[model samples]
Target: EHKGAIAEAGGVKALVDLIFKWSVGGDGVLERAAGALANLAADDKCSMEVAVVGGVHALVMLARNCKCEGVQEQAARALANLAAHGDSNNNNAAVGQEAGALEALVQLTRSPHEGVRQEAAGALWNLSFDDRNREAIASAGGVEALVALAHSCSNASPGLQERAAGALWGLSVSEANSIAIGREGGVAPLIALSRSDAEDVHETAAGALWNLAFNPGNALRIVEEGGVPALVHLCSSSISKMARFMAALALAYMFDGRMDEFALIGTSSESTSKSASLDGARRMALKHIEAFVLTFSDPQAFSAAAASSTPAALTQVTESARIQEAGHLRCSGAEIGRFIAMLRNSSSILKACAAFALLQFTIPGGRHALHHATLLHTAGAPRVLRAAAAAATAPLEAKIFARIVLRNLEHHQTEPAI
Candidate 1:
């Protein structure tokens, strides 16, 4: 409330002005001024006000001009905080659009000071949400800088490790950037980071790997970097639901037939060993994927949804099984339809994963749950769910999740599309 009052009283503009005025010489006061803006920027209301009061431009100036590590760290942090106000704000684009902001932050990622490096990586990570900013950062050498950061920070603080991997993860969202990351010797570091005991570090690493795995070459790089077992470990053992989910997705993408030829790579015509290894990896991945699905299953709760069509039981199960953060994940109708098609896959493991992903998306209270449900409903997904649930060959977990998805769709049948 006091923070809100500060913004109301024009404190943000005053702070921005103070930073700019004192930043003339990289004075000690300028660092504190920028730090104050960073703190205020953590609040959504104040963050928007900061942008309105010209704080974005002011902070960018400080970041681009300040030579002191202390000032640079604070400025990058302010930029990151401004960029992270729970999303949907224009601050992200503002930061990216601020001339020299992305370059300055990218250069700061190479800072000798860990705090400066961490904050810069974080700023890049947040800004990469925008497509134009994402590619621009890569063009600014964000891919190489961040991959190097990821490699060198393995022994650094978890914050640095997480942010380093996160920056790469953000850039890897694009196919070109993903391929660039893999080719720039990023796969090995990310795989090593994925084995970190820190949940956030491993989670970010898994996310990057997931994005990179979209490219068959990168997927093969992950395999060659010994990422398969690491990803499988994350899918089975990570405490974070997002980590497990993305790890499962990464594994799915790897074994999803596109990498079939890559898995057959060998030095000579005598590639029997490679074929055997591929078969074993597939079985292991499928087994763990099935196990991941079953982890969310409670026979008693599922029995309730199975017994009646009412939403009470299904809602209860979804609530119990829901990953609250996953609700924030939005996908295109084509993406949702891909999972619907997967329900007919001959591989029961893929079918189960598809159902599991659908359940995650349509859990009712997610930011995009309604959007996903509408997409599924429009795509005629209910028919697929019914067939999947009734198929004798379907895994029990898949059958159960498919029924739950059907119930979720039914509950939304009368609601207006979001």
Candidate 2:
């Protein structure tokens, strides 16, 4: 209420000015002023007001140079709120970068005060949403600092670990930062954090792994560090839908071209009595494929719900049912049609997963399965596959898989129907 009143009266500028003027004074005044700014920054209009009056610079300075931990904490929180506010112009992020805020935030990540560290890490996490700020933070040694903070204490508070891992997740978007994180030994800590008892830590760590896995070398490093089983475990059991989704994405990246493994498993089980077990494993794999297809089919809705910071209960239930249904059913024209539709999804992840699943149908036995089910002749499947294969935004691996599916489909088209 007070914050709304302050913004209504056009006192945000005055509050930001007071923050700068009172910083040299004792902690009480500085803390109060910073707190006020933090509250005001929560509103988009007031955040813009704060940014216009050079509030970001004042807050960054307090976070950097203030002797009082409380003041630093409040200032960092204020900067984080401003950076996270929905500003299409991204003015707060730009102002922060201009003020050299990344370096100071990186320094604060190492602060002895946990609150300060958490808030600073959160600020970095928000700043990292910008691609340019991502490069800036990475060059400022933010990746190494974040890795250190993530691993600072095995038993660190969840808030600290969550924000640190969240920052790492944001940083991992850059290929350079992904390589830097691996060089800094970031994989082991992330693997360790994925096993954290705290749900937030586990989710953020899984998310970081998802982003980092985009780099082949980093994916190999993560698997070498036992990330595969950890991720698999999270996908199977974690209550957080985001965690499960991220783990699945990491697994997808890890096994992008390894169709041979699926083939080997599908064919290796020769025991007559073990057929049920083989079927169960195949069903499980199908379930995962179906879940990915459904979730990424509409990326905008999924992103908005996930961005709300809510638990994954609704998504889990919806996707789980789809997975179960897909698992029970064999390859069908309807299923193939769904995969073809996913080829046109806005999300690269969805397009990639759909391509990967379709690739499975091109394998030796997989081709036979699709032929028997008449899934290859599903109307427009070939055309859609060709389009997705040539899509500019689809991942390289997705395009490759799509091209392979199209080649196989072309071969089938040339053959006379039985």
lDDT (CA) per prediction: 0.87, 0.71
Error of 2 at 378 (Å): 23
Which ranges in model 1 have alpha carbons more than 4 Å from their true place?
86-88, 265-271, 307-310, 332-338, 374-380, 410-413
Off by over 4 Å in 2: 86-89, 258-418
Q: Residue 308 of model 2: what lDDT?
A: 47
TM-score per prediction, in order, is: 0.92, 0.67
Q: Write the per-residue lDDT of candidate 2 for residues 101-164, one digit (tens) a residue.
A: 8888899888999999999999999888777888899888898899999888577788888999
Clashing pairs in 2: none
Residue pairs in clash, model 1: none
Tens digit of lDDT per residue, candidate 1, span 1-418?
9889888898999998887677677568898898899999989889999999889999888888878999889989999999996456888988888889899999999999999999999999999988889999998889999989988997899999999999998898787898999999999999999999999999999989988987889988888789889999999999999999989988887887778787666665546877677778888888898888788888888888768777677777776777778887766675677688778778889998999899889876677888899899899999999999999888777887888888777767767764
The Cα RMSD of model 2 versus the native structure comes to 13.5
Q: How high a TM-score does candidate 2 get?
A: 0.67
* Total backbone clashes of candidate 2, pairs 3 or more residues apart or in separate chains: 0
Best by TM-score: 1
